[model samples]
Target: MPSGLYRCIYYSKNRIDGGRTRIASEIESILAAARRNNPPLLVTGALVFNRGLFAQVLEGPCPSVEKVFEKILRDPRHGDVQVLGFEAARERMFSNWSMAFLGQSREDQNLFGHIGPQTGFSTERIEGDRLLDIVRNLAFEEEARAA
Candidate 1:
C-alpha cells in the first residue's frame, strides 16, 4: 500500500568538523529524532559511519524520504554532503528500523571489506547491485542483533 520507495546514500565530514565525541552524540541525536519522526512518515533506513564518513540508505514514501534528506542537507553538524545514490525502489530494504545504525561493529567492518573503501561520498567505485547487496546484508545483520 505504500506510494513509493525512495533510497539514497550520502557521506559527510565529521572528523575534521567535530571529532569522535561530537559525531557519536550527533548519531545518537539522529537516531532519537528518527525514532520520534520516521514512524509517522513510515520511513525506514540503514546507516554506516566510519572514519568521518557516512553511508546511509533511506527507504519509504517518496515525499517523506525527500523531506528527511532535505533536512539532512541543511544540517550543520555534517558537511560535504555528497549523495551517492537517489532513485525509486521497488520495496523497502530496511523495513524494521526507523533508522538502523552500523558503527564500527564487526559486521560493519566486514561490510566495509566487501564493499571496498569508499573515498568521500563517491559512488563511482561501488556498483548499484553491490550497494543493494550490502544494504540487504546490513539490514539482516542488524535485525538479527536486535532479536
Candidate 2:
C-alpha cells in the first residue's frame, strides 16, 4: 500500500424515486456533487448502477476517502450501505477521474449477472476484490470508448 492512500468498495440499495427522467436527474446531481467536492480532497472513484443497486470504488488519502464515504452514508439516495472493503491501497484505479459514472449497458448487465447470480444481482455475496475488479474494468472500458 502507498503511504497514506486507501480504497473503499461498497454497495448500496438505490433509493432514488421517480421515473427515468427523475432518476437520470438524480444521478447527474450525484456526479455533479462528486466532481465539485472530490477535486479538493484528491478523491477519485467510479460508480456503477444496475438493478436498483449501486457499486462504487473510492480511492484517495485515508481521511479524504473516509470523509467522502461518511457523506455517502448520510445521503438519502442510498440505503443499506455495505462496505465490501476499506483498507490501505497501493494505488488508485480511477486516478484520472474525479467520479466516473459507468452506465448500465447490456455488457454491464451481463457482468452483474455473473457477479450476483444467486440472488438476482444482489451484491451481498460478492467479494470486495471481485467488485473492485468489475468496477475498474467497466471504468477502463468507458475510458477506452471515450478515447
Candidate 3:
C-alpha cells in the first residue's frame, strides 16, 4: 500500500424518488459517472443499493478518496449521509474494480439480509470495518462470476 492510501465506508438514505424503473436508471447513472471518474484518480470501490438505502466503500489515495466523498456528500440523490469509516488503510480490497455494483440478485439479497435481521438495515447498527468486508467479498464474488 502507498503511504496515503485510505478507505471510506458510508451509508445513506436513498432520496431519489420514483418507481423502480426510475430508481434503477438513477443508480445506473451513478455507476456510469463513477466508472468514468474513478480510473483517472486510481479509486476503486463497491456500491450496494437496497432500495431504501445505499452503502458503499471507496479505497484509494487519500486525497482522491476525499474528493470523491465530497462529491457524494453534495449529491442530491443521497440524504442523511452517514460515513461509517474513513481512515488510512494498508491495502486495497477492491483493486480489480473501479466501481463494482451489487444489484438485486438472489445472492445479493441474501447478503443484505444477513446484515440486519431484526431491525433491518440500519447504518447506525453496523460498523465500518464490517461493512467494508461485506462489500469487498461481494465485489470479489461479482468479479468471479463475470470471469
Q: What C-alpha lDDT does candidate 1 achieve relative to the native structure?
A: 0.71
Cα misplacement distance, residue 100 of candidate 3 (Å): 0.5
Question: If ranked by TM-score, best first, what sequence of candidates would result?
Answer: 2, 3, 1
Model 2 alpha-carbon miss at residue 147, Å: 1.8
lDDT of 3 at 94: 82
lDDT of 2 at 63: 98
- Which is the leading candidate under TM-score? 2
Task: Please list the residue runs of candidate 3 whose C-alpha ends up more than 4 Å from where it truly belongs after superposition.
Answer: 107-110, 118-120
TM-score for candidate 2, residues paired by index? 0.91
**What range of 10 consecutive residues in model 1 has the weakest lDDT sum?**
119-128
- Compared with the true structure, what per-residue lDDT tens digits does model 1 show for residues 44-127? 987777655566788887899898989978877677776767888778777778888875465235445534665212444555
What's the candidate order when arranged by decreasing lDDT?
Answer: 2, 3, 1
Worst 10 residues of 3 by lDDT: 103-112
Q: How displaced is residue 15 in candidate 2, in Å? A: 0.7
Which of 2 and 3 is the better model by lDDT?
2
Our tally of clashes for model 3 stands at 0
For lDDT, the strongest prediction is 2
Candidate 2 global lDDT: 0.86
